[model samples]
Target: MKFLRPALLGLLSLAYPPLVYLGLGHFEPRWMALPLAGMAVVRAVATRERVWLAAAVGALALAASSMLGNHALPLKLYPVLVNTVLLAVFATSLAYPPSVIERLARLREPELPASGVTYTRRVTQVWCGFFVLNGGIALFTAIGASDETWALYNGLISYVLMGVLFAVEWVVRQQVRARHVHG
Candidate 1:
């Protein structure tokens, strides 16, 4: 029960690009942003986590700008905002110690070795780089691409890319584990 709201929110976020594409066809950008802003607020209230709060704040800012300017650019920048917030969280983890990946790794293996710590830090850095690149592309699409193109990339292509990255990382992690076991 506790996880249901957040799970639903995650699904909504995953559907955002397609929803925005459809909503823009039937409504004003300001009208579109209102629901998103409301959702962000709800998510923040539900999570009470700093990361969610930051995301909600960014969502509000985007919604405000969209409503005030009566433009769709802000509506389209949600992906960029998401990427930026994720980048900040991951990068901050790197600086603060126990990089994001290390923290997750520790969940299963509480006593992670020094080598595992180094590996997870490197993985976190890779993810930070991915966010920078992904966010840049999202920003570019929002600014210059057609609505269909933006929706296609943000809604579909970006997710495919993310899956590919995750799969590749998993493969690498498995190989690393094998090497550690046999070396």
Candidate 2:
């Protein structure tokens, strides 16, 4: 339980860019939008007031991918199909993460507990983690990937921001825990 929120936070954080990358970078053969859409759906099902918001976000992400795929040139069917597959994956992942998240949610869950803001914050960390990992891979992969400025920039910004936030939270948590123990 204690380790749950931190871990879930990492997972949720992963949602942001994979969604953004699919729409903006035009980089993947297989739409990597699954995780983002999954997170949105998970949020919807898990919460009462925000289900619509989550579902809408999930739909909009898929829509954006569809639009991007169909927007110009030869109107490729690949992107559209990819979007469908990604949506399916999102659905699958969303169904399962809850069991894991709920277990983690059960831990301490102080005053604010694991609400929307907490989830979002954690997801941001996961998002940043993805950027760091992907960016590092890209940075070292070869000349072409390494040379791409947009890849480096996008990855770096998310990674740095998330890293800073995580560090700050960790430090604060440590201080509070120390005070609780000492006082």
Candidate 3:
């Protein structure tokens, strides 16, 4: 299901922080900042590959989270709630704007000539990435967490996957706009 991505992102974030405190690494948890940042960057760059890379990060994050097992259930469930809320918002906003793709036809720019399905997929991918990451973080947060910095590192990084997936939502919207002109 679509929820799977964010759920996994939640899981991936669980491992992030502990890795850093050990002096092993730090970028992992901070990487949680990426989704929103990626959205901003993609908007400026207008590069499909970058967006795709962000998406891939989301997917990997999601996949990585699965390794956490039940750890995700308690630690990072709020993001999942957030993802659902956003989905409801998106569904209400679109109201079938001609076609699913057309809904995404203009993430930031207008479509010269739009295709129904392609744009829809783009839009969907964007959302899929965001929700997965956000929801994942919430799920990670919900799980059992230790107070020490090391545990926090593992716990937070375990769910930082949201950074990438959340990036998906904004990135997709922006991408739809950028590609719209091309169509």
Candidate 4:
């Protein structure tokens, strides 16, 4: 069930550009944003976490903007808005002890070594940079590029980049852990 939401979301994102271009045109913005926003709200209500609440608020704001008839703005900015929120989360975690990645690492292995802490912090910083770059590119695409271009980046390229980053990091992390365990 948890995986279902993101799978559906991925499907919607993949379909959005063509739907807008060939089917919906520029009039019905609510159809593009409301369902995602509604899901965000539901997730927020279920989790009751501040982060989820923030996402819900962002989605609701997008939905509201769509209702006001600024067609291009809502659909175009959704990815940018979501990335900005993610950027905030990753960047802010660096401001205090135990960055978000470190906390997750701790969950997996409670007795995190000193080197592990440093590594997680560095990984957190890398994620912060990724979010910044991702959000900037997304914003630029939304503003200057066509809808097809925007959807291509947001729906496909962005996810590919993120998956590559995650895969590389996982491989590196395992190697580091193995070395630590051996020596």
Candidate 5:
């Protein structure tokens, strides 16, 4: 189930933009919005977290507005919503102690040196910057671009960019670790 959860999420994320493009033109956005809103509500109720609660309310409002209206513009905010949430998560981690990347690094190298701690902090900042840039691009595409363009950027381009960032970071981390091991 642990693997299943991430797999399902990945599949759903990949399918979302194209589905939005198809549904918005020919079908109602409510078909997608309502279920997502319901899931948000369920998650909010289960977790009782402020973020989830806020998301639930926002989703419900979006679903209602989309259903009541003929235009699918409200539905087009999907990328903005997702990007904002991710940005918040990454940015907020930087504010609190042990940035998310540092926490992950500590799991692998429990005896992390001072240099490693500094490296992780810098990496975490880089990730926050990436999320900010990506989210800005997503918001811009969502608000002003055609659905096809939005789909291309959010679904394909963004993922490719993230892959590149992850690959680069992994390579750098390996070099840094080797330096620590030899130096």
Candidate 6:
């Protein structure tokens, strides 16, 4: 029960591209922006995380700009904003200490070995690189591609890429663990 709301919100964000594609056919861009802004606000209030708060501000700004200009461009930029925020957060963790991947690894193994720390840092760097490439594609799709293309790439292709990355990382992690155990 405690996790349900956040989970649903996450699903909503995942569904955004297709929703925007469908909504643009029948509704104004300003109308479409409302749900995103509302969700961001709810997430910010619920989590009290700086990332969510920044997202809320960005969403609100998009809504305002869309309303004022009657343009869909702002709505299409949400994915870019999300990727930017994630990249910043992950990159910041790398610069400070205990990279984002290390933090998640800590949840499972509190006393992570030095090798595990190094592996997690590398993984975090990989994720940062992924974000940069993904965000670049997203920006191009948002600015230059048709609505269908944007929806297809952002809604389906991006998730598939992420899943593949996760699967590959898991496989590598298993190999690393096996070597650690035997070596």
The better candidate by lDDT, 2 or 3, is: 3
lDDT ranking from best to worst? 1, 6, 4, 5, 3, 2
lDDT minimum window of 10 residues, candidate 1: 39-48
lDDT of 1 by residue, 38-128 (tens): 8788888897688879899989999999999889999899999999999999999998998999999999999998889999999999999
Q: Show model 6 residue runs off by greater than 4 Å.
A: none
lDDT of 4 by residue, 1-183 (tens): 877766765576556545554434645666766665665666566566687678778877877787677465676777787788887887788897789999999998899999999999999999989988998988988889887788788877998999999999999999999999998
**Over 4 Å off in model 3, which ranges?**
1-78, 91-95, 98-108, 147-183
lDDT of 3 by residue, 1-183 (tens): 556654545444344334323422333433433333333343234335443355444434443453344222222332344355555445544565443434445563364354535556556656655555555544454454433532553345434554655466567657665776575
Error of 5 at 119 (Å): 1.2
Q: Where's the lowest-lDDT run of ten residues in candidate 5?
A: 39-48
Task: Compare candidates 1 and 6 on lDDT and give the better one.
Answer: 1
The Cα RMSD of model 4 versus the native structure comes to: 2.8
Error of 5 at 72 (Å): 2.1
Candidate 5 segments whose C-alpha is farther than 4 A from its true place:
1-7, 45-49
Please give the lDDT score at residue 34 for candidate 5: 63
Off by over 4 Å in 1: none
RMSD from true fold, candidate 5 = 2.4
The list of candidate 4 runs beyond 4 A from truth reads 1-23
TM-scores for the candidates:
0.96, 0.33, 0.33, 0.83, 0.85, 0.96
Query: What's model 3's TM-score?
Result: 0.33
lDDT for every model?
0.93, 0.43, 0.45, 0.78, 0.74, 0.92
- Model number with the top lDDT: 1
Reference-based lDDT, residue 107, model 5:
96
Candidate 5 lDDT over 96-161, as tens digits, reads 857778899899889888898889889888987887888788878878888889889887898899
**Cα error of candidate 6 at position 51, Å:** 2.4
As for candidate 6, its clashing pairs are none
